[model samples]
Every structure is written in structure tokens, then in C-alpha cells.
Target: MERFYARERMGVQGSWSRHSAARVASAQALRGRDRLRAALSAMGFRLQ
Candidate 1:
């Protein structure tokens, strides 16, 4: 039973790490998009 619990904890930790990584990636993508938009605006390009 203790081993089972340990395995479960490990699985939970793995999922948490994955979630954190995904969040960071999403944030970086959003920042990149914002930067692109700003650049386009500065160039006076309209998105239509």
C-alpha cells in the first residue's frame, strides 16, 4: 500500500510539472504575439 501511494504521488508530481511547463510555454507564446502586434502597429500595418 505504501508503494502504491508513492507511485501515485510521483504521478501527481509529474503531471504538475507538465502543467507548469505548459503554462510557461503559453505565456511565452502570448508575449511573442504581443510583441509582433506592437511591431505591426509601429509599422502602420492594419490587420483588416
Candidate 2:
């Protein structure tokens, strides 16, 4: 019914927000890893 649709819309919006936040966090982590790799290379470091 109408109530079900209303609640479903809210749930979808909440889930979308959660997914967006996770994506942002993941991108930041990836950038951090890239920076770490660059730093390690600059310092002549490598992992076997």
C-alpha cells in the first residue's frame, strides 16, 4: 500500500547513503596505499 511504498523509499535512500559512504572510504584507502607505495619506492624499499 501507500505506507509500504513510503517506508521502502526511506529504506532505499538510507541504503544508498551507506553505499556512498563506503565507496568514499574505499577510495581514500586506495589513495593512501598509492602514497605508501610511492614513499617506499623513494626509500628503496620492497617486499619479497
Best by the lDDT measure: 1
Model 2 lDDT on a 0 to 1 scale? 0.62
CA lDDT of each prediction against the hidden true structure: 0.63, 0.62
What local lDDT does model 2 show for residue 33?
Answer: 62
Model 1 — TM-score against the truth? 0.31
Q: Candidate 1, which segments miss by more than 4 Å at Cα?
A: 1-25
User: Per-residue alpha-carbon lDDT of model 2 for 1-48, expressed as tens digits?
Assistant: 445547777443445556556645765656576477778878999855
- Judging by TM-score against the true structure, name the best candidate: 1
lDDT of 1 at 46: 88
Displacement of the residue 9 alpha carbon in candidate 2, Å: 34
lDDT score, residue 15, model 2?
50
lDDT of 1 by residue, 1-48 (tens): 445547777443445556556655865656576477779988999876
